[model samples]
Target: MDTKFDFGEPESQNTVYIRRVATSTLPEEIREQVPDLDSMYAVHDAEGEQLALVRDRSMAFVLARQNELSPVSVH
Candidate 1:
C-alpha cells in the first residue's frame, strides 16, 4: 500500500540541510587541507546554498543550532 501525506513545504525559512560530501568532489585547494579524510559533512540552507563544510555530521547539526537554524538530513 502507498500513502501520501501532503504535509506541505518544510520550514525553509529557518531550516538547513545536512549531507555528506566526498573529498574528491571538492576543489584541489580544499582537498589538500584534509588529505587524511575521505569525506566531510556540509550544511546548506533550504534554498540549496552551502553555508559551511565540517569534518563530521554531528558538527554540522551543532553549527546549525548554534546559529538558531533547524537542521535536517538531506540524504
Candidate 2:
C-alpha cells in the first residue's frame, strides 16, 4: 500500500485536509493508528498543532466544518 500523504488544501486559518491513497493492503497497524478516517482524527503537523478530524477521501472535500461532514465508520 502506498503510504504517501497528499494534503489537499487548507480550509481555513487552522485547518488542512490530507488524503492518503493507500491500498486495501494497508497495514492493520496503520489503520489502528487512524481508526477514525471519517472523523477528525488527531494528527500532528510539522509544527505540531492539534487539528479537528474531518472526512475520508470518499468525500469531495476532506476538511469541512465539523458539522458539515458525515461520519464514516471503519471496522
Candidate 3:
C-alpha cells in the first residue's frame, strides 16, 4: 500500500449528522427529563459536536433543515 488514502470527510460547512442516543447513556440531569423514553435523536455538526437532542428522528432532521444545515443519518 504505497498510496495514501484520504478517507476523510469532505468540507461540509452546512452539514450535520443525526443519530439515535440511548437515554441511559446521557447525564443524570438530562436523563431525568425524559425518563419515559428509552432513546432519542441527536443532531451533531461535522466536527462531531452535539447541537441538539430531540425525542424523534424526524424532529432531528427537521431541526437541521430549519437551521439551513444538511442532515445525514449516522446509522
Best by lDDT: 1
Cα lDDT tens digits, model 3, 1-75, are 799898787659888999999999999998999999999999999889999999999999999999999999998
Ranking by TM-score: 1, 3, 2
The candidates, ranked best first by lDDT, are 1, 3, 2
- TM-score, each model? 0.84, 0.24, 0.84
Clashes of each: 0, 3, 0
User: Who is ahead in TM-score, 2 or 3?
Assistant: 3
Total clashing pairs in model 2? 3
- Cα distance off (Å), candidate 1, residue 73: 0.5
lDDT per residue (tens digit) for residues 1-75 in model 2: 889988886544444344343433345665677665533333223343434332344342434334353333222
Model 1 regions more than 4 Å off = 1-10
Query: Which 10-residue span in candidate 2 carries the lowest summed lDDT?
Result: 38-47
Candidate 1 per-residue C-alpha lDDT over 1-75 given as tens digits, one digit per residue, 9 for 90 to 100: 589879886677899999999999999999999999999999998779899999999999999999999999988
Pitting candidate 1 against candidate 2, the one with the higher TM-score is 1
